[model samples]
Target: MKVLPRQRKAVLINSVLGVAVLAGAGGAYSAVTSHSDSSARADARTVTVAKGTVLATVSGSGSLSSPSDAGVNFTTGGKLTQVNVKPGDKVSRGQLLGKVDATAAKETLAQDEASLTAAQANLTKVQEGQPSTSTGSGSGSGGSSSRGSANTAPTPTPSPTVDPAQLAQAEAQLTQAQNAVDAAQRAVDGTTLRAPVAGTVASVSAKTGDTVSGTGGNSTAGGSGGGSASGSNSGSTSSGSSSALSGFVVLTNPSGMQVTANFSEADALKLKPGQAATVTLNAESGTVLNAKVLSVSSLPVSSGSGSGGGGGGGNSSGSAVQYAATLTITSPTSNLRTGLSASIQVVTGEASGALSVPTAAVSGTGANRTVTVVNDDGTTQRTPVTVGLEGDSADQILSGLSEGAKVQLASVSASGNGGFPSGAFPGGLGGGAGRTRGGGAGGAGGGFRTGGGGGGRG
Candidate 1:
């Protein structure tokens, strides 16, 4: 304790250096322990890479609809006298369903027939050189003038003396009469509602004693002989003059059933007609329908509140604007009901027996994907990978990976080399979504005849 000041100062400096050395060693140990703990957590996220099948698919939800959904309306409205069929009744072409009051239609036909007869009689008189009654008086006066001159009746003009205006009027009248008759006949035919095709009646919107019009909601301006109403065949009203029709009948073709699914504009454009797909019914879990893309609408289906379905009852909600596409069911379509909820998964791309790893195991996006390869010695090494298809669950390795390699899912924080964080699994890769492949080779030339793709969702 009685040491010189210089001696004490040297001892103090030595002691301070010893403390500093001890602190540095403790800090290094703590750093090492932190790194070890992070590694342990990452091991839990490790997944084994293997060779298998992967399916790249597009999915959307929609309701089952009829490829030939038709709404029936009367050619002309009248008091409904009879309803021969009920909803769900099967009908065939020309099959009579019901009739409206034909009293007015019959009267109209009779009037047109009488008018046609008058026009024909007049036209015949003029054609046969007989002076028409309308022109007879003028001719008689002309004859009187000839007599007053003490001269023989002026030689009747060699040419037939026919009034052009009268002749034209007669011809126009005949045509009008004929058209009137045709329209009246068409109205009569419309009075008796008939099936345009063999199908199950989905709905009957008319009843006896109800007054109806000639045009229905789904009718065209040229209400031809199609759907439940007709324009060309049954004679339709002009759009300007058409009135709301009653007696509505909806028919669905039993042989043809299709699904109408809505997707975003971007997704819809990715689909093409003839892409293979599978449809699963939400109501009947066991039912699966194999289908092919029949059409992809260039324009989104014009929608309303989605009120009426081909099956008669439809949902009125979820009216979001979306592009509509169709898939025709090729499988046995028995027991399928319209308006049933369905999910369709269309395979966009697929590959079989390709080297692959869990999608979560691949870190980074696009071309910079990296994987923490688990070494045999219980350690990890960051490895760059050339990923081909980043599937829903696993990714296809174009290069930089091999079968049976274990890798940890990426969960880095701050720096890119932060290793895996503490958690259970990563990005739903292990949550039993079934294995799905991702990515496409961007038009890699191949034919359906070559590569064996995995079956799409069922």
Candidate 2:
């Protein structure tokens, strides 16, 4: 058959256009299918409810501290003469840590002792008989002296009597002198620093020959006398300028090592003394220690001015109120040190041998809690459930679905979008070819039909 060049060229162009249209349609269909497959993979999976144990725990981060941590300081200011202990030295209660020069103190004591001795002697004389220089005039003696001139012998003065008033004055003076002597002795003793409690020296800020004002760091170790979070503002040795660590020496009772953590108000309310707790050190993640809640502070961490807690364990930032909690390590290791960061988990509630399901399968809370049950017929139904002891991995199901009942896990992706691209052009090439044949195709349908038919028939 003979064909003109112009006609042939038109036919060739139509054939190419038709092939392009088919290729576009195929690509669109493949994209939609791939997206649907990924969405399915991201969807929910079914799990059977069964009997298990669930532990409800309140978790928080904190730091290691010792209730028996004491900041040893000199009671009176003087030149530091001797330091017997350094950091890491073990000492007993009343052990002398260091001393300031006691020369002036000794001098004061000597003067007070002399005064006390003089006062004692004066008191003794008053109690016996105070010598009276005043002569007593007697009527008989006066008459005799008037009659017999100088020959009348002066009657011997009666033996001196102790005046009650004079005795009382002397006793009072003695008491005053005794008190002064005791005070002087205490001043002399105050020149030396002693450990208030038995513990290891955690740090020493003062050295021999340094003059200390003795104005700060007078806190007693074992604060408040129990296993309670003192929330002390003690700073770590990591910072040199911290005044909290600026004591003569920092003493820590290694045996009293405990953890101090802060919990939100919601969690704090659920915590109480004697609750079982677990502590994990931040530096040693694998080391787990058993402990129990020793105390929970009634006031927020920010509200208290406690100088008892070691390391800034409680959270004082943010608008939320955080309560300090103390946990005692039942079996502490020798390696445990104050100011070490740790995470705490206290078991607040527990349920055993109860019907439970994966926590992810449950939605909502309280009386309105619900789960999606997967029926045997492949249908899903939203069912209300009564839950108890909502744990980390699983939740206790009190009712609404028997044991062995299956529930669908919550989907990661949203549902009900028709499995199609939302922003795709309306009735465009993908949609047009997807919905109709050549004559009713979308995206310039009439032109596509003409070129498409010619390419197909050819």
Q: Against the true structure, whose lDDT is highest?
A: 2
At residue 323, give the lDDT of candidate 2: 92
lDDT of 1 by residue, 312-373 (tens): 12233434345778888898766676677899888766779999887657666678878889
What is candidate 2's lDDT per residue for 363-414, written digit by digit as tens?
7756889999989997889999998877767889988979989999865332
Per-residue error at 131 for model 1, in Å? 10
Which pairs of residues collide in model 1? 72-228, 213-245, 223-230, 223-231, 224-230, 224-231, 224-232, 390-438, 391-437, 391-438
What ranges in model 1 sit over 4 Å off?
Answer: 1-38, 41-51, 128-164, 205-212, 216-247, 252-254, 297-322, 371-384, 402-458
Cα deviation of 395, candidate 2, in Å: 1.6
| RMSD per model, one decimal | 14.3, 14.9
Top candidate when judged by TM-score against the true structure? 2
TM-score of 1: 0.62
